[model samples]
Target: MSVAAVLEKDYFTDYSILLDPYEYFDAMRAIGPVCEMPATGALLVTGFKEAVEVLRNNVDFSSINSTVGAGVPLPFEPNGSDISEQLEQHRDFYVGGDLVVTFDDGRHRALRSIANKLFTPSRLKQNQEYIHQLAKTMVQQAVMQGGCDLVNDIATPFVTLVIADLLGVPAEDREKFREVIDNAPPPGNLDQSDAPTENSPLVFMGTYFFQYLMDRKSSPKADVLTELAQATYPDGSEADLLDMVKLATFMFGAGQDTSAKLLSNAMKYIVDIPGLQAQLRADPKLIGNFLEEVLRLEGSTKATTRVARKDTQIGERKVSAGTRVLVALAAANRDPMRWPKPNTFILNRPKIAEHVAFGRGVHTCVGAPLARTEVRIILEHFLAATREIGLCESNHGSANARKFNYEASFIIRGLSELFITLAAN
Candidate 1:
């Protein structure tokens, strides 16, 4: 067994070093830039240069046909085949938008044109007030309540509601929608026997949305769905409705959970680091630095997968066509070769943004700007409003056997719940 295989079957890697992940990554970096994980038959890239290579070299390794559950440790099943199919079904929907984060060539270019309008400098500036108001509401709701779980109470709603609003869902249905989606089973959980009819929230949502698209067809409002439904290709043809459902579910699923994890981790790290939090509370200017550093030190979503289009070299190992590469963003973010004094979190770390938390190249993360903005808005409100919040329970549900007791899951990396109590300034 290779070193990686041993590490996976047995968490021989000093994982406490991973409570601060940089250490583990640094060790991996020393073993050449990339190493193969025998356990999953996947290549693990830990160096900044090679990892970036995997992302930037689009022709050699394609992101479009990448499988989500290809190779990773997970507690639950991940239906790699079905999820991959659903993801690809929405390709034409982005015909007029810049789905820059996940597409290539013609599709990516089309999205770049259409999505540009939504993220224009003026649009972002205009939404500043709207963003602040939502952040204010989140803080206010938890204000007199004394202590609050940042993950469950504040972060989830603030970001989810904002994305929903941007997507054209009725604000009234936001809470109910968030509840349904947040707990939706992982794509792996889908079973052909079940047919999404368990009267579960996921079922309700799947049914409601398929029907919802039709209901919005007549005199459609100017929401994202309507725009998506109404959007035309270069040939002036309407996008298919099936594509719309795929995009809608992607918007909600990808937007809510990922952004919330970032917000939650960012806030928790800020509160946990007294000196840094105090600096932000006073200067406010440091918030940007704080954000970058958090992304660097504690990434939002941990890892993403890509498949090799053809034979290629990953670090010292030669990878053949169809090899699965697991880009450990969290580990790569802390790679020693990439950053100076890698493990420590200095709020003003000059090279902080190098972290691959948001990803890179064709499939980097479409929601990155929005995710950063949400974190910025919420943190700005919290820093200005509250003086202190602490983790009431540093609870660990399962003993982290791996280098970080990382959820034995393959795809998304996040807290099940980060329980905390907030005290007002």
Candidate 2:
């Protein structure tokens, strides 16, 4: 059956779907592997196989079409090879826009290849220790407060600190970095907004990042930025400073946003489910499988946009050139065809590790290792420090009460506020 005939309703713009998307996603998936959204004129691929096909076939489903300045109309066309010009256009459209998630050109490939090296095993190991230390400190501080919003008090700050470390912000200036982030609205808050205004927090972040890049270039310190400044593309050419700055800026903000969401979602499951918290506390080794299950059930990303470079068939749906496709990773992870009893969070599911939480193929998130390390370290510390963790009935009422709220976002799945109390062992 044609996707249009199989699906009749518009799913993309329906805000109600964000409240509880799994059921609706399941319904959509049942229609077929691919369904067309008439509202946005985009095809939504829900099946695991079809989603992987689109992600892997980057040549056919090009990501370059969905640049940083997508959707909103702009005076200056965003198509250009000039890195500076691209940044200027992106700035005018939306601040803190980076090429890492956008550009799929050769330059992007080169940048990704170079950036992937930064997360080497040694660096990741070092960061893991640091994250454990930081998590212990955060958990201790939260315990002292008796009860705290885990999203704000723990996951948010923990992810931000890790981002600061990765960005090579100085030890003395780390607090300043936190201050900047705290002052700004949460990332992805304005993703669904009509257009980015001049005074958005994104703009503030972009401005600060530009200056930070300049500072790093001038001082040539022993940080990631310093390394980026002196690095070269895969070719024998020096990487553009603006390119490096933009990549760094994107990674800093986007990394924190997604990692915090992933960690928050994982913590929510740990606290919400019965016996799960105690089980993890008893055998912390289960934390890895627990996280993998969380990624499979409630991944950080809901979907990603791609544009068809040429007329192609995604599953049975024939997508024309220039057609926008939204690959639903969350739905794909839960696809019954790929996962047996997909809804159930089996801690030791043999194939759980194959879930595309960080995506697949060349465009896979480079920060996955860092995010995993952050989540693992934080959970280890949280479980070790606390004998029991429970939702704060005072702050969030009871689990059955209408006290908790997830962020109403199209792309991310995480709690806006998760108030929990950790009893120190």
Candidate 3:
């Protein structure tokens, strides 16, 4: 009946919940589709239909509080049925408010246009060979060592370089970008404070991208950066230089982090499940559907935040102005109403693409296609090069008593380290 009785722990700050969230998601869903958390006054949308309703209705719900969720208090008190004006006035005060993810309406559309250029079908087609070659080379090196921490040795570097190449970041500077990102704390890492300090990677990345875009404007070049610098809004007007820089850096940071986590998450299943590796290896075509199932069961992002622009109803629950809504994508993906036996992983599940792993509506992830390509290519390579794939007993113990550490974050869900043994074919 009470939040404490159901959840038993703080969903945001508690470490145990971060390690295993599916049980808690079940608890939340048991209450109601759209249940309100009395502690934070944030409604948690755990049902599939309810989550989709909230995601699609951008008119009544603004993404201003997306990054912070209900973790922080609103700058001003809600007085009426619409706090849209207040959100705008104090927008700069919210975390990640200026980033493209939080932008709404026209501004969001215009900025997304410029970001989309880098991920065009033709652009990804051109990068396909590079992705495959890079995956092959990286997986080969890991196989040479017999075993490697898949998170760091393979997934992290593999996705990082893939994004670097796609974005036209210079080859000479790739390692520097990798080092800067690796050294920086993950967005919501719990051991360290989650708050962004002066040393945030965005500041560093923004500076580098700013200089690059500025140079491209002055001296045009045959690169994605040059095209992005010259790209205009839907109305054919030029975009702000600072906005462009923010978009580029955000893409760079988000692109690698989520995709790397996804790769590690998929590996956990590949090794844990009996004969799954051999099945995929023998029939490479099943790899795409297998990845879709992984996304459904263990998506990198657990939940995204939205704030009510005005009074609205999410399902039967009435959310007032300024109310914070936590759209639980991971929970929605497993909702029994949507997927029968949602907890069990079934290969080749019907309509697998309907999962909200990358989210939905106008605010759906712009990098979804790129993330899929990176993971699929690397997975194919790992299967091709190895006779057998398994977990390192030293790191994860044996199958019955397996112990693993997940990154401490309320937002991202991923293994901290996935050491795996590879038997080369």
Best by lDDT: 3
Sort by lDDT, top down from the best: 3, 2, 1
Worst 10 residues of 1 by lDDT: 188-197
Question: Per TM-score, what order, best first?
Answer: 3, 2, 1
Q: Can you give the TM-score per candidate against the true fold?
A: 0.79, 0.87, 0.96
Please count the clashing residue pairs in each candidate, in the order shown. Answer: 9, 0, 0
TM-score of 2: 0.87
lDDT of 3 by residue, 225-291 (tens): 8887888998999988899888888888889988999999999999999999999999999999999
Q: Mind giving the per-residue lDDT tens digits that candidate 1 earns over 1-425?
A: 23453454411122343244444455555656787665566677877778887877776664543323334232223343223333345434322122234465566555544444444455556667878898898887776687676767777777777887777676677788787766654331213112211224434554556766887787687566676666565556665566556556556656776788787778667656657678888888788778788887777655566666566776657776656676777777777778887778786787677778888875667677778787888888877777776665455232232112332233445555676566787
All models, RMSD in angstroms:
6.6, 4.5, 1.8
lDDT of 1: 0.62
Best by TM-score: 3
> How does candidate 2 score on lDDT?
0.73
Candidate 3 backbone clash number: 0
Candidates 2 and 3, the one with greater TM-score: 3
